[model samples]
Target: MDDGFIAKPLGRRQIDQAYPLVCAIAPGLGVDQWRAFAAALLGTAPKGSGPGSSGPPAEAGIITVQNALGYMHGLFSYRVEPNLRHGRVLSVDNFVVLDLFDLAGIAETLLRAMDLLARRLGCAAIHTTLPERYLVRDSRRNPIPDCFRTEGHRQETIRFSKDLAVVNDNAPAVAGGLHGVE
Candidate 1:
């Protein structure tokens, strides 16, 4: 079925257009921050890399799904990294889909694209974790998990995280010294 939707690597020209879609999932990220991050992911102009540089790491990039009208509906950033257990693996993050009406189709398309990308990169496996905010408490009511399962992906591990309190760097240093240490 031709839904007039296509998935392709995000280009430097569409960074602004894709920013809104990214904000839909990452609400706290600012435009300037996202611009730099996207630039790095796109391997166009990584930090400290001069003009005509070789670009960022070859393993990292961002992919976006756009409609026939040239509007971004979803995006995911991925990088191929060496893993202790899986050898070289393709890790996906920041997966965001704004087209709620066709969430399943878009999600599936993105997953398939990741699969192809992983193979092309010679990755041993592909790992993806959906953002917690996008997941529903009711598993049966969530289509994201089903879409992943239908695409031959399995839930292998559960992730646990805790937000650490940020400390002010400008705060006075405590007067303490280790015993017998300079």
Candidate 2:
């Protein structure tokens, strides 16, 4: 029987073990901050009060994949929400691999695990918010791997930014009275 890649809820030990890999991907994060974030994701509130400290911890999920050597290949975190459009959806917030150049089947395995998790949770869809530059695309214009079909996307919001302090002659002014400075 081919039981899929080993995945389970992240405990404190696993969180500690996984922090270094996470830091490699996202630098400048202190261990304390990572601990707090991991705690929140695991539904274990921190000792102090803060915005995330209150409110029943969101339905968050984290899964880490290990290679044959027992080293981590990648991990992903998501939150489950009741969606009016899709009934229920799993919103993937973080999907990290040690190195994209050498995925070594990690991406495929992890994504399949995510699919199983979504189905187990009764989620109708899986959504992710990756930046445009990081989006993976093949020649066929598929951003996702062939294991799953890609659904077209709709723009949910328009992001606008203005420089309130820069008043240089080269800057342009907009109707909102904010300067557009590079």
Candidate 3:
């Protein structure tokens, strides 16, 4: 079943084609916004220069799962970053899988691909926070966690975030502290 699908790095040329899948995951996102975000992930300039343009580090990219006929069913964006505790870690986000026919297989394939990419990049670990929508405790609609467990991945943390009030960009740094020292 997994053989019918191919997991490949999403290229700059296919950004437009991949937008729909991205929209499925983020409904309110605009086309321009999606294009720019995808371009950054692909390490290509938002306009003019093509796929190989230097933007983000080479270790970061978006991967998509496509069927034999070339339909994108899912995707995830990832970047390798230095971590104080882990040395270097591969962090993935925007994981989406649209093919319900073989959700388990697709999820497994994506996870395996991430593991291989992490190893290739010499990462100490692979970290990803499944989107909040996927954590609703409904097993019927979410099988990704099960796939992760089957692949030997354990849930190490539950993340919590509280949005801070916006701060002025030109606000003066506080005096006599590390905030302004750097």
Model 3: per-residue lDDT, tens digit, 1-182? 47888777787789999888877778878999999898877763233221223322347788778888988888888888898878999899989888768888888778877887777678899998787767756436568787888899898889885534544454456777555566
Clash pairs for candidate 3: none
lDDT of 1 at 34: 93
Q: If both were scored by lDDT, which would come out higher, candidate 1 or candidate 2?
A: 1
Which 10 consecutive positions of candidate 1 have the poorest summed lDDT? 48-57
* Candidate 2 wrongly placed segments (more than 4 Å): 1-5, 44-58, 99-104, 131-133, 136-182
In the range 1-182, model 2's lDDT, one tens digit per residue, is 12334544455677878887677656777988888888777763223211122333335756777755556767777788887788898777566656454453555666666676666667888776543334555455433343334323344544453546564545466776767543
* Residue 69, model 1: Cα distance from true site in angstroms: 1.5
lDDT, candidate 3, residue 77? 89
Candidate 3 lDDT for residue 162: 58
**What lDDT does the true structure give each of the candidates?**
0.77, 0.60, 0.77
User: Model 1 residue 76 lDDT?
Assistant: 90
The lDDT-based order of candidates, best leading, equals: 3, 1, 2
Candidate 1 versus the native: TM-score?
0.79
Local lDDT at 66 for model 3: 83
Model 2 gets an lDDT of: 0.60
